[model samples]
Target: MMESQQEPKVTIPPLIPLEYSNRMMLKTILECGDDQIGLFGKTVVVGGWVKSSKEVKREPVAAALKPPTAAEAFPPSPGRKELSCVEVVQSRIPFFKKIIRVFGVSSDSYPGVREKFEPVPKPPPPPPSKFFLQISDASSISSLMVVIDSAVVPVSAGHVLPTGTCILAQGVLEKSSSHGKQTIELKVEKILHIGTVEPDTYPLSRKRLPLDSLRDYPHIRPRTTTVASITRICDTLDFAAHTFLHNHGFLHVQVPIITTIDSEGFSEKFQVTTSKKWGLGSGSDADVRHETVKAEQHIEARDKSKLGTGVKPEVKEDFFGRQSYLSVSGRLHLESYACALGNVYSFGPRFRAEKTGSIKQVAEMWVVEVEIAFSQLEDSMKCAEDCFKFLCKWILDHCPHDMKFVTKRIDKTIVHRLEYMMSISYERISYREAVDILRKVTDKTFETKLRWGVPLTAEHLSYLADDHYKRPVIIYDYPKAVKPFYVRLNDDGKTVAAFDMVVPKMGTVITGSQSEERLDMLSARMKEFDLSRDQYEWYQDLRKHGTVKHSGFRLGFDLMVLLMTTGLTDVRDVVPFPRTHGKANN
Candidate 1:
């Protein structure tokens, strides 16, 4: 084997001093200067989108004078302007002193020096002044007053930095004593406008844009404060979920997005086909299928008229030779892993083809599905409960800045909701108990009547979790007839070991159930549900050999975000693209 050569390392020189170019985040700026004032002298670089900008006048520095005569200095003449200036300069003491460089000043001169007062000619007015820009990088936002006095580049003909411009600024950290408070600020020196947005034509504004309008411009909406904050919350949730799962000894797995078998075994799936009529060619699979169908229809008409015997023609094959679809859930694939891995989970996008018009519906969404082998229904529920609580507490501790923005703008009760989710124990009850609670509520009206064997509606779930309990509620043991075929049938044979975790404002954020491990029972359920046995033969094989009782659940990742952000009533608002019944804009 040949030996590999080492590559040389490349380094970029700093435009600002190395000490200040530590690239400190805005959130930590206070901590850097709070205790030790030494950090205040260093220069730092900050990058963010400009929130606002305003022009301000600049004042010239005060001129220095020569040291006063012995008689003038000893008496400390209050009437003498130079004497008063010296006293004011002396008050600053050892902490701070102005450095004045006169034409003939010596190095050992006294602190206050006076030369013949020659009125220096004032420089011409600075080419259109710069303004203070309030900037935020989404994580931690701070204001930067970038004056266009020195080498600061001019943005345009007359204006300074415009709002919404993304710039990287190098500046000195200084404490402001102007407004009686010693607040920190960045005196920007060199600015690199990484991105410039024309304020008038920009889709995102400093002011809150209407949520509907924002949905129309999905590509650019992330730049807005509302969407940006929600995106951060989602990112944090992803981290929290993975951290919680990994910490609890759950192996993360990736499942296929396209498959032949429907996890739910329902017709509500986005069909994937390679058949094309007008696009690919004339003699394509689609054309072949169409001609065969036409010929069969003609033959059938002739046979109906007693002219000939008719037979249906076989359909031609497509690319896959059989029908395929985008996965509606990863639960079935996750089940295969759980049977061997003991504990496993998968997090990714899932698709549905329902023409749902409700605010909660979307064609594409994210699901965090977990499966654990040798675990019963109760064990699965406990793990799910702990995971949910852990995520709630994790976001509160890690994403304080974004959560504060959400609480103030989106929902005032968001923090309280998260706290309640974390602090209180969730209420757990069987399907029979849940129906009884709904039946006793005679005072309130329900759009759909509450009863046994019927699938639970959103309103019913919300009322139980939000209004009735005022906290999260996990309802288990759903009627087998209403749930999917994979759910384990109870001993009584009436209900399945299924559960749903519903919370205030958003119902049914999570759904899980114990999977059937008995081959015969699972096959019987598949036949009962009219699902093809041939398609699920692999699924049944898991139960055929050494099948251990396993349970799992899926949390709708988008719904979780929507619940945390109260302002987003529609599920479309939380996702990157609102892929609904009609709209599919790029």
Candidate 2:
């Protein structure tokens, strides 16, 4: 009865363990060291881009006195014991796996046998028996050496692997016979995948491409050592920031990317427009008529308003109603959440349209905006400092491999600078004190003409961090008139309780301030700054209903990455798709 029962219709497919399902990273085997004798004879599938390849020619099987004979090709079928070298060679075998030995009568390999017959033409030195390839997957600076035999996977003599040719192959790791080469190498038995490259047009074919030149080929530049290393470092920094914020009991609130209020007050911003742009994409006659009617209606309404408008239209035609823009900062929206929810933070993209040509400046950037309720300037500074330190330590601990790679190639002092920041306490000084140091310096001349009310330039901040203090310097108490309207005015009434943290090689990375919690004072400041009361009435409501002293900071994410990588001078180098003035070549 049991034998008559039918088996289940569905059969489970063979399960592949995660570690073996995909090709092993070169880093895994490389970290095992040059001599991985313990791992020898183990089979692994690995993939990487071809960094270089060379064909090694060996000594021909026959001696110099006579050429290889046709009889050496093999013994007659009747008496043949095994395939001879001549036969294997003629069979297009690139490697001699075993010694040729025949039991039956065969042509003598000895010179005397050749003397018994007319000499035959010696085949030009046999095609290189082995192709040596060095490939890297950008996992590490060290590349894995792969040995391929044409006998196992036949390739023509002219076949060459150009740089950037990606390949995946299954092979066995074994001890290398070469004296000075890597102690262990992959002996490829089968090639699973191959992405050949055209040497003529492959952009990254050179051994070392300048960082500037890499901008032209952003799509493929991650294969480069410096760019790849920087990319990994940036990735770690991003995660570290989130982890640090989460560990500290801070709530991450994603603010609107598009907003009506200009968070930075006077900074230029990208106007957010509806995607229904006219005259860009082709459309049917009905679609055109629909768009034309909408435009006509808007123009007619504007014309009607110009002459005799009694009441305003309920909602504007813009995407968000009225004017909207890509947010320059998330602080304003995030502050609302902090006031209601205690400690809150936001980290995301921010767009700026200032026409400055500084290397570190980009049209689009990332910022970590933090707002702490009932906190003062001191608390804000401490929170930012801790966050920065935690991020540096995180990268140092989790990204040692990438750090070492960048240190060796880009900036040698980067590691020490990071260690310094982690161990030593940051230096804190008032804006007045920083100005005194700048004026006292006779070595470098000032470009802005040093003044108490003027905003500090990159040169000034760099001088304080890189040269004078030789560490991170937090400058606080800037002139209230020059700062944003929200920064709390100090007791003196002339300066606001604002601060900026400047680091060596990376000028001002963090900006923090104690926000004005008093409704009366905030409204006055906003009015004095010529801000429209109607536009910022909602912001004022935070103070009117229930306001507590709130402090926060905006840390430039790209600048933090630049700080971690000592070699990079520009934010563009760290950002994968840098959007700058007139250039966004993705």
Give the distance in Å from residue 582's predicted Cα in candidate 2 to where it truly belongs.
Answer: 0.6
Task: Return the lDDT, model 1, position 428.
Answer: 92
lDDT of 1 by residue, 197-257 (tens): 7768877654777888889899988767788778888898999999999998999999999
Candidate 2 — what's its lDDT?
0.81
Q: Give the RMSD in angstroms, all C-alphas superposed, for model 2.
A: 12.9
Write one digit per residue (lDDT tens) for candidate 2, span 59-157.
666655556555653335675578655555545422221222343433444434332333466556455578888888887767888888886777653
- As a whole number from 0 to 100, the lDDT of residue 233 in candidate 2 is 81
- Model 2 lowest lDDT segment of ten: 93-102
lDDT for each of the candidates?
A: 0.76, 0.81
Best by lDDT: 2
Which residue pairs in candidate 1 collide? 20-43, 65-113, 65-114, 66-113, 66-114, 66-115, 67-113, 67-114
TM-score of 2: 0.80
- Total clashing pairs in model 1: 8
Candidate 2 C-alpha error for residue 462, in Å: 2.3
Regions of model 2 farther than 4 Å from truth: 1-21, 33-35, 58-128, 156-160, 179-181, 275-315
